[model samples]
Target: MADYDNSRYTYAQVLAGTGYYMKDDKLRYSAGVKTMQTKLNTAGYDSGTPDGKFGGGTDTAVKSFQRAKSLTVDGKAGKATLTELDKTASGGGNASAEAKNLKKKFGSIISSFASKNSIGEDVLGGFILTESSGSGFVDGALKIRFENHIFLKAVPSASTTFKVEDKVHYYKKNGKWYKTHTGKQTSEYEAFNLAKNISENYAYYSISMGLPQIMGFNHKVTGYDTPKAMFTGFSKSEDKQMEGFCTFIVNYSSGSLLKACQSRDFTKMGQIYNGDGSTYGPKLKANAADYAKA
Candidate 1:
């Protein structure tokens, strides 16, 4: 980041910048491209060898990174893409220390948020642990769980687009329609991207995001104008995700859920959050205990 010209990278509201690499450009070699390739590789996008060349592998990697980060899906290493790549690759993938780092970086914010919202601090920690494994991101991008059932119901066109008999995207499980490709970010987003082709708004609205695992349809209670806004904001930082989580806790069901959170009644919290009677109370309690020890 030091040797590279900042003018070449795009930051917020800065449009005079030049792109280091455009999508349609032919195979080219440069130190700038090499640096980007290195970062992309470090960020786990697999841009082939850092040969200082903008080739097909690098292009595909750039597009994958953009897709994961919720940036424009163009395969260009422009201002926004480069900037985010630098930030993401700056740190190593030390997942074992995720909980420690999460607390160390945002302990004050979480404590103050918990106090103000009358929620147990450990309860908040439990939610983060259970929802996102104490990290707001997965594989150098914001964590998301796409719901195919929600997507099918949210967008009428999706029902026709993906038939249950296909046994690929949709499947009937215990008399309920379920998404076959789910439970992992890569597979989930793959399905999500397919759904996005049908209806982008419904696609965004159907996913749960960040450490809080808050669904996009709850944007209004979380103080966002729309589901896309909530997705974008949550993708930027955990602080914004925390803000949305707190706001939603305070506003949802007229603060009754907040009362349950304060009382450490994770059964009620899970019932409200998951929409099923399968209370995650024991797991949440176990997570909180582990975080306390850590």
Candidate 2:
């Protein structure tokens, strides 16, 4: 980063200082935005793009990261926030007691999310099962499936009469999905799901924000109905969402259901049903076996 007068400092300076600029990349804030995105994401904040423009999504993602880390959520990347961010990358150091405290806080966030979203932990379990045993699925698809489960909510048809597809799965891609979990797909469904999940599930605005497009929910969100809390109102923020999702696994997520879902992974998605369990489950497994060329 080139040294310039502080009074004349701009976002460009912030990008340069952060090593996010380059002549080869033209508008270099994208790199800076990526750096910020990685840090914020690691901290459990889900900025939409990490494209390095001072946009609304970035602001919201910053606010969420600040909120999660207990920093002031003014949406401005000030010294304290930047310091914490930098130290976090370097593994947190001699900034102040606040920074050390921030580390502890961040640890708690990961742990909490892990505890709440045991599904995430076990989600790997399910993914591995299908990946290892249910061969013939699209390669690089196992990880994709893992991500799909985190953000989507599978609910039976309103009539509960067992439609062709047992349920329609919905989720937030940016604020809700990416914020809550991890993903990097470029599919149309992925993009649409990303937008829909944010808009429908969390109640954020249904418009583009900054680098990290923090979209609100499109309509309503759906989830399991069990143990009272299992139905909905899972996690709060990035940290808490991870927590809640993990917890849902402990309380309601079923390997059988997951297996069923995995079985259907080879078949057309959204075809597995609830009441037709006896019927669909076997068929799904058979279809997967065929897809595997078994």
Candidate 3:
């Protein structure tokens, strides 16, 4: 167990930078870690000293906080963790108001884009609800999905290891290979660093960007000249990000998915969009129904 303190820390300090504090291949040392430690300690989570190093104590404290808050309990300070931390630190209310605001702001954007793309607004709304629950930003920026396979492919000659759910897997770190489940949810800065270390191309493809979570590698299919260009453009605003998403769906399915969405054929939509016929299809239908009521 760690020691707890009642020293308050500002939300800004805690949320500054990448807003991540996790134990990966190496312990993280950053102001974000220190701020998180301080916040966790203040909240009676016992994160040990407010040091900038993310070790076992910090990880356990983060997990405890997540468990207490009904979060994912991944022991990672991702967007959700940070948001809950901010709310707790500031004594803010639930996210219902924020969700309502996001939905209101997104209505016009979704309507316009869906109209131009010949899709139904309800379908788009359902997708948004499924993907982000009306929250466009994750930890104060666009969402990021780290792709370790792409990163490793870019370095074809380095020795690397990936751990997933208590399993450690080895990689040659050299030569081109693509493997799934190598990626982890991470902040944009950390994901970007992984990409930069590999190559610009890998950086773009190694992570999905924004609300639609479009992969960087699909920039060409999505009508962007380059992955960097797509990333920069999508990060501008929620509207642009959704537009990029719409464009990707149109291009990827050659407009068939849009037709499916228009007809409320969530089964077809899920098959095309998610690449399988699974529970996602019915879940999407349920989401569509709920959004229609809203």
Q: Give the top-scoring candidate (lDDT).
A: 1
Worst 10 residues of 1 by lDDT: 1-10
Model 3 per-residue lDDT tens digits across residues 132-213: 6344466667667665556666665433432122333322234432333344334345546644764767667767787777
TM-score for candidate 2, residues paired by index: 0.26
For residues 254-281, what per-residue lDDT tens digits would candidate 2 score against the true structure?
Answer: 4343343433341222133223333232
- Backbone clashes for every candidate come to 1, 28, 5
Worst window of 10 by summed lDDT in candidate 3: 2-11
What TM-score would every model get versus the actual structure? Answer: 0.54, 0.26, 0.55
Backbone clashes, candidate 3: 5
lDDT of 1 by residue, 192-281 (tens): 677777888988998888878888899899889998999999999888887777687778887777887788876687677666323344
* Cα lDDT listed for each candidate: 0.68, 0.35, 0.62
- Angstrom error at residue 84, model 1: 38
lDDT of 3 at 62: 83
